[model samples]
Target chain A: MTTTLSLEQEVARLIVEALHLETAPEDIDPEAPLFGDGLGLDSIDALEIALAVSKRYGFQLRSDDERNHRIFASLRALAAHIETHRTA
Target chain B: MPAEPAFPLTARAPGEVLFRRGAEPVTTARFLAEAAGLAARLPAEGPVLNVCADRYLALLGFAAALMRGQVTLLSADRTPQRLAEIAARHGARCALSDTPASLPLPVIAPAAEAGPEAPNPAIPAARIAAIGFTSGSTGEPQPHAKPWGALVAGARAAAARFAVAPGTSIVGTIPAQHMYGFETTLMLPLHGGGAGHAGPVFYPSDIEAALAAVPAPRLLVTTPLQMRALLGTGIALPPLIGVISATAPLDAALAAEAEAAWGAPVREIYGATEAGSIASRHTTREEGWEPYPGVAFTIGEEGASVTVPGLPAPVPLADRLEWCGQGRFRLAGRLTDMVKLAGKRASIAGLTRILTAIEGVEDGVFLAPPDLDRNPRARLAAAVVAPGMDAKAVLAALRERVEPAFLPRPVVMLDALPRDAVGKISRAAIAALAWKR
Candidate 1:
């Protein structure tokens, strides 16, 4: 048996834990908008997720990075970025 | 009294440090020279929408606007809709932005240069320096214009209140766009002749690093939400001369916690966008606020009104208060039913208007319960009577028009709304509504 899980699931869990969202990790749609209507995350949530990602992984997430909107577009996008950038 | 000095409000001794840009100390001369260069390049007409992310660039943009006789429009709500609204309403001819977006108005970058040295331009006391928009109870962004004299007076009062002497540097977490941020972080440094850190540091580590990088006698200007977040990080902070909290009310406990942790007295400012910084209190020591020097309060049946120096007339405050003698007063509840979430003001009535305005929504109401635990900002719960609308659908519709700060969480759809004979939805009835989400 192989234990293979998607990075989206891992990032979803991280977001839920970091922001203390009411929804469970599995319930969060990977492609659903995380901010302003879908998951209802605000700017504060974005900062918290950024901090958590930097602490959990070994790379700093710059807020002024132009690709921030694209990177944090969805759980799948954020997870993909984390998979490629995470040093730890 | 002696005549006022003709130098620019931000003028300091040549070598005095006024800001730190990534560990490099930026002197007053440097700031003035760069601002003059930028001002020389800017149009001498039209309002400027400053969208500079770096606090220093924002300051330079603001100074250049003042020098060029342009009214600076400061709004933190940078949504395209909000920016478009500002451009339309304020006749904003250009935006000073760091981003490369194509705005309705041309975007001008505040580029640095070694242009011809010119003495800092003199701003008339009557000249309107900047216009700040506050989300009033109407949920519409209302303009509050600050004259150069009023800002200079307010900055002097604040400097005296916070004990920010010349060469004192402040590193703030609040955005430069907000009223308190405008006064303390920018105005205090410029008008009151103190130093400032230009970075918009938000995270705890970033804040700590910014503080560490700056010199001593530093002031940390922030809001309750940001302060709570900073304390939550539990990181050891550098020595701070004082901590200034404004916008939301700073509770005594949080104030004490900050004082104990940071070893600096927490000074809470009581002000609104209408009147910049009116009064301040050392929250750990007392509950009442001492009006800034030359500021007086007249308590009436309606509420408390303030008369500040250099203002034409007294402005009535929305908060109810009683005098404690010697120009000091304690805050009672709000005179009107308005909710202040993270410094932005929105009336419950105004929120209800947006809620019921939804095409599918029939009857709707919103209520704000006092958050004793300091819950996520201010949690506003709503009850709706739309037959087919679910909580998610209602919220989705609301997200399209409403600012994210005012959007109600846990919007419950009920079969019928509890209304009194006069058609008033009582708080008790709203609380009794069952949660649908």
Candidate 2:
């Protein structure tokens, strides 16, 4: 039987590929923080992820949106948002 | 008595656009009225630290302080420690910012109140206007004070050099606190009778959006780091007359590519926090610098120093240069940036240039091993962010460009270099990276 990757795994792979993370995709904890002390990612990284997600899922991540802090809280959170709103 | 010019420096026709906030255009009359209202409300006692992230708010705070005769303190670092230091220096507990809670000081938000606009205060040319904090690339951030007259003169010179005309609008990707952004984005518009986009754009798409929002002919003021990111995105920007870059070394290849992509020539401004804007060069056309009109440079065995009309003393620059007379010069390298290895010499700046110029290298920096004082013969090290490229391959590429002795001993691959908000890779950060290896 073929196995499909979970949303968390898929998003982790995307993050690693997009940001050129030294850590392996499976090594990234799903609930770990993605900003500040977590991954040491910055505003520029966030924008890159937003652009990549928009291209892959056909949904724009607006900077001024109130839920930005919540959506970008963790990889799991971001993946869940994409799962709900992704058009493509 | 000498005749005093207009206090605010900029007074355009009421309908003339002064700035664009998002998609909305603000007229000169409205901006002046708002600035006058805010100036009336500013505290007259202490130096005001302007930390507003919003470009429009920052500009308003700056103008308000100038009109109030309070010196504006420009710091690129928004850390609480820096804010506390600035507040303690001014002997005040409060600061002026749009986001009050972000700073350590007791925040006094500038005026948004409805009232009669006050007349522009008569500000003297020699009055100390603002203090700029250095980028801390070498050591601790040092304070450089600038008077109103010096700032205005520098702005006029930059406007002429960049060929910024009355209808030109600027969209800057740099921090407002830095000298380059302060000159090109804020002072140029106020003194040169041009409009500026009030958006602090970072992302490529956002920069494209910001550029499209402003009317041409537009000028994109950016740093090398931001320009690289913008170029990578392959987004189409609006029609531009020219692009001005500063705050870091812009590679010639990148300059040519940018010029080709945007259909506008790329000009680089060369100056420091102490001297403000002094010279310009078309990066693709020349390796030498053309000093601003009325500006002269004195190069000696010590280093290069510049003298401008408004400054009281000649400010020594950190770079070594070979003066090619007739108001032009070629930069040899940074004065203190030379590294000696195996009885051979190379500049850290030159090594960094070769590293970043390598194809597929996104961002990179070189550092003399942190224990250099203990062991003067310590080899160079680097932190690079080139995906799909191994350390050995990167070293191989470096070997082709520089002497083998100057090559990095261990090239640590990272996702990104730790650059500050103004795109300056601090020496401390570099030392930490090298020590990690």
In angstroms, give how far residue A81 of model 1 lies from its true place: 6.1
The residue-by-residue lDDT of candidate 2 on B1-437, one tens digit each, is 96875345564566788788887887767777788888777766658888776677788888877767788888765556656766676655357766535665568787544346555455677788888875333223467888888888888888778777888888997767767788888888887757887775766766788888888788888866566666765678899888888766678888999999999999988887789888889999988899998788999998989998678899998778897766689877657776644323456777788899899899998888645422323567888999999875787687555544556765788887887889887667767766663
TM, chain A, every candidate: 0.85, 0.86
The pairs that clash in candidate 2 are none
Going through the candidates in order, their DockQ values are 0.30, 0.18
Question: Given candidate 2, what's the lDDT at residue B314?
Answer: 97
True-vs-predicted CA distance for residue B308, candidate 1, Å: 2.3
State the displacement of the C-alpha of residue B164, model 2, in Å, after optimal TM-score superposition.
1.2
Write down the worst ten-residue block by lDDT for model 1 chain B. B370-379
Query: Please, what is the TM-score per model?
Result: 0.90, 0.74
Once superposed on the true structure, which residue ranges of model 2 sit more than 4 Å away at CA?
A1-36, A41-88, B1-7, B11-15, B111-114, B135-139, B337-437
- Tell me the whole-model lDDT of each prediction, alpha carbons only: 0.78, 0.74
